[model samples]
Target chain A: MKPEYDLLVVGGGPGGALAARTAAEQGLSVCLVEKRPAIGVPVRCAEGVGRDLLTEFMDPDPAWISAEVERAVLVAPDGYRITLEPSMAGCEVGYVLDRKRFDRDLVMQAANAGADIQVKTRAVAPIVKNGAVAGALLEQQGSVSEVLARVVVAADGVESKFARWAGLETAVPLSEIETCVQFLMTGIEIDPGATVFYLGNEVAPEGYVWIFPKGDRTANVGIGISGKKCRSGSRPIDYLNRFIKSSFPEGRVLEWVMGGVPVCRPLERTVADGLIVVGDAARVSDPITGGGIYNAMFTGRLAGKIAAEAIGRGDVSADGLMPYDAGWRSSKLGMALERNYRVKEYFITLSDEKLNRLVHSVSQIDLAQFSVLGIITELVRQDPSLLLELRAIRKLL
Target chain B: MLLIRRDICGYCGCCVSVCPQGALELIDAYLSVGEDCTGCGICARACPLGALEVADEA
Candidate 1:
């Protein structure tokens, strides 16, 4: 990497890759850094993205597309299954990706776009000049160096550090974080075209377990337990183990992955003087589902575009960078994040009985949309008494 | 005191985001604790792998 660039992006996930690509494409000198030695190893995601959203970034490549999902099932606590059509499956059913290849493809695109991509290079601290983040103190192969830039984009994933070092409180609270674990196992009987979600506190308190099919008999079986609910002997892995034992008794383990996701509202501020934060780093992941790839890409691209515009105008202060923050907050993705956070807060308080009833009610409806609001609307239609609780979220839809 | 069982740690950085003090850092995929850690045990509870533990003051 050169001693400096117009834009410096930290992290190699979809967010950073997109940020680097967008900024570089806009004629800015860009450098993207990933602390991991390679891209997309130790896959942290459940490898699921909506078909519509996936198509927006790149056409599905067979090498990275594990499954072309057509249907989804929601298994209630009492074992009542509700089958959802692909259109009504929300964001969970679309494409179960092989993220190991998918993530690399994105970074390759950024590299092709003229951004200098560095692997295993970390930004140990932010470089501030004149009280603004000008660049980062980067560490590469055990040696540290100063790399200056006009703007620094913190696209780091859930464990975002550069933004914190630059003076933003990005810490996710215990109640707002999901401690997750996933196992890729084969020999399990699963419909390759369908993904499944099992909901119940007993199985995963304040969270859910999922089966994202990778193939006919192989899938990413994962559980996300609320961090606040995780206790000794009942951690996320323990719950996932119980699920594997019951659902895929003879499945052979292929891989194990563990991580955390922020299921909270977007950060109070995602931009600072000469800085912008994107994706999970900005707490832009869906609060209910904890999905973030699309959000990350969306914000990453926006940050790039706005950064270029701000620099063109000869201003890179927080005020000049406010457009990146404002642009996303009003977009469709931002609305969903806000709506999902509220719905998540409400749903987490529901007993399994309420969820079962709601799931049963929605299963019978020909819902126009498959979002949380759609389910809530149908439930309120069946029982008018829920209008009070539904009214708050009703306004958003 | 706070203790980390590196043997079982997957180094996914789950414990870092929830630290109120911002006392934990995940660099090079390695979980590191800073001097500000008060043994609050929040990271221990947030760890999905149960790799962190906190001992009460004597």
Candidate 2:
């Protein structure tokens, strides 16, 4: 779209689009590019977000929201259900979105803010000068061109090739990566106001099965297991197929999709000289639940704000961008990721029997003033050994 | 060699991120293998669609 700009954003997901919009609103030139011909077409996510989290980026528009979740039901291996009411609202009890319109809406907002937007444009390589990323070589419609900028925002989703090209080690290990598959199923009986999760090693193996209802009779039925657990006869799709047969035999499959989610720590360094990485590319998805829409928008906005400040000061070095890194790491989102990663690692080690016992114990009680400490107290009363195990992990925090 | 059945592949970028060798690329819904590939089969194992395979070059 332009020979050069103050900032060039690679990828047009929530993160990239918000970055471009925020930067452009700050009076910096911006261009956002997406490799896909259309935005959010293949809909890889479960499309669930918290009510407050969605509001942080943009007001929840009914045009994009498919469902408003009011509660969550955690199904144990033995079919014991633990229902978390609205008081436990911090989790995914919020909105199931139609990401097709949601992603496009963010890009449109960026365009309205004076940022140039281009789809079907892939950033093939980073244009490095003096060992700092200056811009990228973008290819579109079988033609290639260079777009140079003072700062480059890498929001290229899970592939993250742009960050890799800029010399960042963006590869995720099999153990940390979650191999996922989901089917949009209709004609399935589902509670229109509740999101359900089935947990246990037998169910997902280091992950869980999610049923996010889109309407009265349609839902996103999905499973995400650790990549290390994936195999020929028991891959993610295999698991999903089995679960569908058992749970929703009469359901009609409307669509099917598969992808990977990085359920690991964010990159050690999210910013380099003249470059900032955001969203799944930075591995900012929630380590326990694999949710990322909020994290992406948060980091994208922060990156834009910080990059604008850096440009104003005429400094785009890693040191200049270090505040962006430090800013997010110290934010509430960063703290939660660090905390949940440990919890995820511990949960995967729990046997199905143990999970059932724990779920049964928790379901027997009513959490009046739900809090982490209260939950820990409740858990310790049920299983004393958990206290020592939690202590071992808590010391690290 | 790493064989990619483009038909079976969903091109979700799963293999590209899991390759220990950083040898696979998902180019606009197409999987591209770079020379850096050692045929370690990590991507094959990580692919949810079972679209990738490590085999003899011949």
Candidate 3:
């Protein structure tokens, strides 16, 4: 069967939902499809977001927040710690969200905006006509159907087939992908005010381990290992379980989430003829930190706004949507993402010993007086030799 | 046509970072070559962005 709509958004995650809502608000008839049975089921995120990053798009609804974070603790491999005060940390200083509520809330907003949400509907392929993407073919409840629209927004996550199917070559290499495993645990005494980050190859190997407090007693303890490193045989979960046993031995496990993050740079082109890809699908997450929600939401808003304007003008080609890409590249989200990608590459190349030493060096500095970016830039400034070391190290990449 | 995704490129300086001949350097959050890229495509693949592409050099 063929269903027609003004805008057909594939994948009802944050990006898709927001796109649908924004498009609908612009008076476009919209339909959002998701493969999952519900909006937020089978949570894939680390369940953390910065308060400042979130404020630009929408207000923090009390229903979506799980905890309020006030500080950050940067831990070295040898257990040295540098605490970050909220004011210096910039945005994201105050949130450990309940992603279930967070994801549901975005979709709820879309639904309230008059978009048709289709759960358990998987977008199998892009519908094309005259060599241009027109919409998508969806598999709903074991039956296949076609949905047609003037524009298609591909918001499918890291394993985004739609983006590839739509003709944009968005492939994340193994080295750039961080395989992550998280456990929601209780019985661990953690300060709700602070989120802890542990950096060292011995612990995570090219990535790091994070402890994001959901409540005073419960936390999402997780570890991320580079996929290239994992090819040698150590798994993310194995490392995470080992860390838990050694660090929070008394903590009780409540839930688990295994996922991958694209920590590489962003895609060169996010737009194709008659189609736009957003969020993880477009590699919109932060490379250094692996954070995507803020960037994803920001990109989604731009895509939605651009798509609405294009549809209204009846111009839905690649040329018509170039503004979305240009606008995003100039935004603060884009600037930070690009800078972080460079820093992440520098970080992953550090040897275990260098990492430990760097962490030790950082732990001694007063983080409250400097931004994370400022601290790293200072580290590079303090040791001109380290720049040479980094240059020498680049020979391996 | 060689296409590079800008967002996924990790400026690890590896493409230019690890070039034995000093062919690459980071310029404004991206790795660029100094008229001697060698068309090796090493930087292209070494790039987490998959941003670098060795095309016709045209």
Candidate 4:
């Protein structure tokens, strides 16, 4: 007989794991399906996350963090640098994490909360009954089965098909996708506690290069370029290689990873009858930075709470899940994401000259006490003409 | 051999930036490999456009 669950989460990434944990904590029966044979295998991230963001819902364990970050180095195309020091950076702390361990920890937390986790289980399609999602057809280890649930949360990553299957308009235009590639390297000369961001069209075009230190003279160095600008027939690896050879001439790469970052605004809606989507699955990543962990977990918590409430009310419909939207939007994560999206679009459309000019302007700011958003707002304030561009970008936010 | 489809390349230069062997170069807005091309396939994977095609060099 097929197992029944009050909630079935499709994907055991950060978002799904958190959703499962949240729902189970609320006393709802939850089952999580992970397509990967083991959670967090073939790790695909720069693994840089804010300490404070993760702590809001769950405390950080030493096993998951590689290093404590204290500074951020912003470099322009011409090699001009701006340093954001630690004293004024507040608890907006940063950490380079062991992602595999981090993901496993989340799954462990969910399992401890009583959610059933099945590995190597893929959700093939939503099982629709009477015009609503009843459950999903799952393929496990080459065998197929079905599981029924009252509520389903799609926490799949950036390339989520579940949203489209659930009839949500989840397509991200190429212009809004950032092609990223990272190399884990050793023997590099860099500050072990500072994260570096390289900006300029010459180096990364519409995207940027990042050097996130992983500790002990190693770092995850990578670049992400806007897919629309990538139409010029240059791949991200080509750009990364050139940068590494020139910048870190003595660095030796130990591993390589290539992936996509979604820079689009959050989806118009994240809920449907018997369904909720969180994290990258719902385009909940930072539109400007392409970071998803914090937002993913935040949305996951909202989805989990709403799912539990719906199950408790015996009403797992679209309207029942509306609270998830309201709750998440009211949270700091949502506001930051919305503002970041506006900031991202503004920077994405800038030409090389404009980028250099913007960087030059930014270098004059005392970022120690200012958030990136505040800096942008100040820039707009200085040049009132930028208000027009800000207004156009604000619509998407 | 990896063939990069010109239409999809983002020209973000990520491939050029991460290549370990210095095999790729940006010329006329397209990524071209020199004789030292290692066929590492990293370039293809790094291509967000899915523009790079990696096949065994015949």
Shift of residue A318 alpha carbon in model 3, Å: 0.4
Please give, for residues A21-76, the per-residue lDDT of candidate 4 as tens digits: 99999999999988767897657688989887788877788998998898888787
Candidate 1: the clashing residue pairs are none
- Candidate 2 has an lDDT of 0.89
DockQ of 4: 0.09
DockQ of 1: 0.83
Write one digit per residue (lDDT tens) for candidate 3, span A1-397. 3389888888777888889999989999999988767888667678788887788779998888888888888887777787777655352476888888888889989989998898888887799998779989898777888899899999877656687777777656757777777889999989877889998878988888999998879999998777666631366756887899898999999876756688877779988778988998888888877888877788887888999999877889898988888888888888877777776777877777666667656544554646556556556666777877566334322
What's the lDDT for residue B31 in model 4?
62
* lDDT of model 4, residue A98: 88
lDDT tens per residue, model 1, A1-397: 8999999999999999999999999999999999999988768889888889878878889988898888888899889998887665463458888888988999999999999999999999999998999999999988999999999999988888888988999889998999999999999899888888999989899999999899889999999989999999999988998888888899999998889999988999999999999999999989988888889999999998999999899899999999999999999998878888888887898789888888898777765567677787788889888777666677765
Q: Which is superior by DockQ, 1 or 3?
A: 1
Off by over 4 Å in 2: A87-92, A364-377, A395-397
lDDT over C-alpha atoms for residue A202 of model 4: 78
State each candidate's clash count: 0, 0, 16, 31
In order, what fnat does every candidate score?
0.74, 0.74, 0.00, 0.13
Regions more than 4 Å wrong, model 4: A89-91, A366-369, A380-397, B1-58
Pairs clashing in candidate 2?
A: none
